[model samples]
Target: MKNTLSPSFSRRSFIKTSALAGGGMLIGFNLFQACKPEAKPPVDISQLNFNDFNAFIKIADNGMVTIFSPNPEIGQGVKTSMPMIIAEELDVSWDNVHVVQGALDTKNFTRQVAGGSQSIRFGWESLRQTGATARQMLINAAAAKWGVDASSCKTENGTIINANGDKLSYGEVVKEAAALEVPENVTLKDPKDFNIIGTDASNVDIDKIITGKPLFGLDYKEEGMAYAVVLRPPAFGKKLESYDDAATKAISGVQDVVRFGDKVAVLAKDTWTAMKGKKALEATWTSDSKLENTEAHDKILTDLLNGKEFKTMRADGDVKKAFAAADQVIERTYESPFLPHNCMEPMNFFADVTEEKVRLVGPIQTPAGTARRVAELLEREAEDVSVEMTRMGGGFGRRLYGDFALEAAEISKLAKRPVKVVYSREDDMTAGIYRPSIKYRISASVKDGKITGYHLKEASINSNMYGLIPNFFPAGAIENYQVDVAAYDSKITTGAWRAPYTNFLSFAEQSFFDELAEILEVDRIKLRLDLLQKVKGTTDERIQYSPERLENVIKVAVEKSGWGNAKEGVYQGFSAYYCHNTHVAEVAEVELENDVPVVKKVTCIVDCGIVVNPLGAKNQIEGGVIDGVGHAMYGDLSFKDGEPQSKNFDKYRLIRINETPIVETHFIENGLSPTGLGEPTLPPAGAAVANAIKAAKGIRLYKQPFIKHMKAKAPLG
Candidate 1:
């Protein structure tokens, strides 16, 4: 693999650069060679130079510093967050730097993905060191010119200050700095001295977004870009059998009709023409491909869980003995249905392909995966394909799969011209690889106010939970805890959603824990605190997660929310979880009106190490909490005879502005490595809201969207 510079300034002073990378353009660029999908190894520290640092910063003679953000900007604001790390260490003012979204150049960039909230955490030190590396180079240049010791020189706000107070702008020293050798090890500023890391920084794209810029996938255009729409099978596991395009060809703008495997694409000069052509076309398929229904699917899962055999993922002590000796055993089943991402912008991509190389531009979460998939199809090396990332309206986790990107490449290759493949909102919703439907059968035994046994068995259709995270809570706390999983295969497409398995499971598990707290007649927070105390007290070094960290955040959340006391009528529920290496605790306030739960407010406390950008982090926390609450209250997707029932926004429900509640957020300052905020804040919200509903309505809810149960209950008096 190619050698990229690590921020570690050990005793050696060498940085590697590939062909097109220069000192001004390449610092902080992660140049990595291709490897297996599941493997990650550091770049060789030797064979290094400044020429190929992957070009994150470019200093013109005019001092216009353009920093290229490597990851995709899918509305999570990595375009601003990632660069802040670099600019902070480089000692440059935010006003002096201009950020550019970097295109997918695998040879020069690694980990350009935008999902899982990993951008900041992964690049935190590397980018900072890169900025530091540049600052040192500029200092070295100034010191040589002034004939002074480098230690006497200090850099600030893109200029070098010599002992005599003479200053040299970074632009004036760019050429000289480019020729200097990098230092072996430079000192990083302590967190207490940070000016940008903990301060408030808004999203840099706000102005462009508000004024309606062409940064989104749908707004992308090329000189000869034609619009193509794919007509997928009506149901899962079905394929196109025959088609009559006589009426389709009659459309004025329709150019050609072609088929790729199970999909047919109608090419037109514009999206409207292609859409119209698609409607006019006549197609037929097998009478029945894979018939799917909610009842049968749910039954299959339940049947699987009843069997004794299960892929036991985690097991502590002997659950049998603990349960057998228990004072009482309580069990409850909770469920959540499949939900679509429903991003503001539908799936779309633009690609230009030729035999030698392929160029792609669009919004995607995993550009490396997209490049790899496209390269695999074209039978070319990964470096031969370049994918450009654009700002997305939203990603959730749908963009993790490169199918939409692959579709664009295929269309571009076939048409032999630049083509933009677009999916209408209807197409996006109906032809979905949705979040897997989940079921939880939770049972616990209580013995004299101390838990004797805890059992959790989760069942799902199609996808087995890939995370299989060993670090889930209660792992190190309970002695006889057991976690099992069962999957019943189906034809429906199931993949990652925002928080994936944890999203629905948290609703079930957290609420179930709340129920157990009542059964044991213990305070909900106390029950969790008791478990956490067990973890912290344990001497085992192999504990899956940090018990000390979990306890700290939970304590802060309780203090900040005033959990036990509420203003007269408002009822509150609390939940906390750790994911993506970040811990979050949330409290939801609810009041019932006309038999419906109205979430009046939600307060969140997050501990993601040192807050990188407080304002941006809070925005993420607020958005994630609201999103989880909305899904728990009203979101659901189902199918009949293998065809989706909700086709568009007119039929599907989304959380509106009026539906948003007052969100108050607070962050814990630990000055540790910053973790991500994109996903961790979302996992606990569903359960917090569900538990609050149970308290207000005087009824326990085991079903998601809690709206499903409201219909059966009479209106509130």
Candidate 2:
């Protein structure tokens, strides 16, 4: 692995030269060496067990080139963005380049799973270096033929040009470049000279999306593919007593019925037939299971929140003393229910099983993790199991949990035939993993109209949103703070959903700050600016934000939203959050309509280090904001007697076009290392909307399904 933190080249240089190459393509180069490279075994350009990969620029004898990617794109715009990165680095015309999905051969490709908004961020450095590295080799090969110094040569549009105007096409020089030992420490262009990196170019994959090409996992098809669906226990721990498969087999189109463990699966020739067969089974399940319903789970979490001495995720300073010294102390508790990802395409997988090996292909976030699990389940060598990732309908952390894929593999193993397990909308929603419900208790003190301290205790099912603690947030924001966390381990399973804990933390933290400003009689914007200033560069050993960067976004959002100014009857709320190396600030304009708070508009300023693709990044932020809004105010997954109450979109609400607010986005133009935008922007939105509602209604809400909390308190019709 190469050192990711080194600084070798700036992005500006690549942009300048890219423009001079005639603006036909945009390439992003990530200079990993941070310095000149030392001779080493040329990066293993071999196709092997890898998940994230950018294939070698394959130039045919006819001058056509193809750029292969192993990352599955699910509309977060990886298809458009990643190809741009590769084309930019290769100095190839975007028109002449064909981008395609790579095979799941780990020895040959990176697992093509896309989530965490990391599609572009991961490729930003390597793709550029790969292009630069290959271009230099080609230049050297062409220069050797002309008896000229390579320094006098420039590459343009897949051809090498010497000072004397002599040129050779890349296709003509590849043989020589291939024979030469890969060069060491090739120089990269300066950011000031860049033409492509900072420029706005159209996404390369837009055409495919518009035409509805087979670009996603749901679109994948194989010959002799049997459709199957698993009927698992209603809740997490409920087990099967017995099943009457006789009726299921009588259903038309039903092929075979197989029992693995706690559940049975019905296989058929198509999705509709398999689903019909499943309903016909009407299998009996034991009620003596330990799955807790929503109400019971809520009671357990609420009880835990009322207790003291929880496990601490972080603690600093004497929080007890700080709260004691204040003349007034404010405490608030907030809660959010579980949510489903509901990726548009639903969950499905195709697998071919044999006695010696298993080949599984579907939309998954972690290909290596899936392969490992499949290997274990099949009792086969890990090397014998292979996974090919398809463009997911949506990930949002749902794909991170491989239950759907596992179910497919288990069915394929038992049926002794290649099978594709497809989940109907209802099955996917009810059987899906969820974002854990959480309860947060926040306390802060104010002394004579000045802020003093803040303390938080959070109760949830897991420590991190995605089960991975990157320390990307807590370590960067807040000061003199204490964070205590306690989890309620239940049969209900959870996994990372987009921003994960950042979503809830931002809502809790930012909303509380807005309330704190109210208590201090300070402007919300100014209060955040002041708090940000205190921690910007203090060596106080408690600050984690880039004060200047955070402050810049705060200012931008304020200016765009016309903050510090007022309009009667129209309320505005502001919130900012930093995570995944990106800082986002948003201001929501809101009003109460029909006794329900409605969001009118939201203006956002996002700084994700350096944006690899402006259009794609914008789409991601917009989508994430809308997603957060729906989850905070509308989305709720509940249960009764341990059975999920909400089965599909009809019951589980989603934010539709009519509900989507007018969103205007601005980017913070700082030439910093690019961070992920996928899940970062989601955290601040719930809080921003919550704050807006407070301004609109003069009341604070501490629970999600925000409208319900509001309606319950208002007079009945």
Candidate closest to the true structure, highest lDDT: 1
- Candidate-wise lDDT, in order: 0.78, 0.72
Model 2 Cα lDDT, one tens digit per residue, 1-717: 122223233333332322221111211121222122332322332332222112445665344456665655556666656656666666776555655555554543443455555655656666666677667778998999999999899988888899999889887887777566555556555555455566665555444445565656777788888899888887766789988988889988899999988978899988889888888887777776456788887888888888874877667666788788989889998888888888888888888889888898888877777888888887899888887767667778788778778888889988989998888888888785888888888887777776666677777865433322223333334444677777877667777777876877788878888888777778877887776665655665444457788889999998888985758767888889887667899998887677577888888999887776787788888888888787888888887776788887778878878889888999987776577787887888889999988877777878887877877777412
Winner by TM-score: 1
Error of 2 at 357 (Å): 2.2
Candidate 1 lDDT by residue in tens digits, 1-717: 212344443322333321112111111221121122323224222322222222576665555466777677777766667777778878887765666666766555566676677777777766777777777888888899889999999988888999899999887787888787667666777777778778887677665566575668898898777899989898775668999999999999998887888788899999999999999889988746459888877888788778775788878898889889888999988777889999999999988898888999888888888889998987778877988777788889998897888998988788887788999998899787799887778888877778888888878887567423544787788889888888878788889999775788777778988998898888999889889888876766656557788887789878888988888778898898888778888899998776578899988888888887788888888889989988888898888888888989887877888988888998888778888788887889988988888788777888887776665564544
Whole-model lDDT, candidate 2? 0.72
Residue pairs that clash (backbone atoms under 3 angstroms), model 1: 15-48, 15-49, 16-48, 16-49, 17-52, 18-52, 21-51, 25-55, 26-55
TM per candidate = 0.92, 0.89
Off by over 4 Å in 2: 1-54, 108-113, 199-205, 462-479, 539-544, 566-568, 715-717
- Model 1: weakest 10-residue lDDT segment is 18-27
Supply the TM-score for candidate 1.
0.92
| Residue 64 lDDT, candidate 1, scale 0-100 | 49
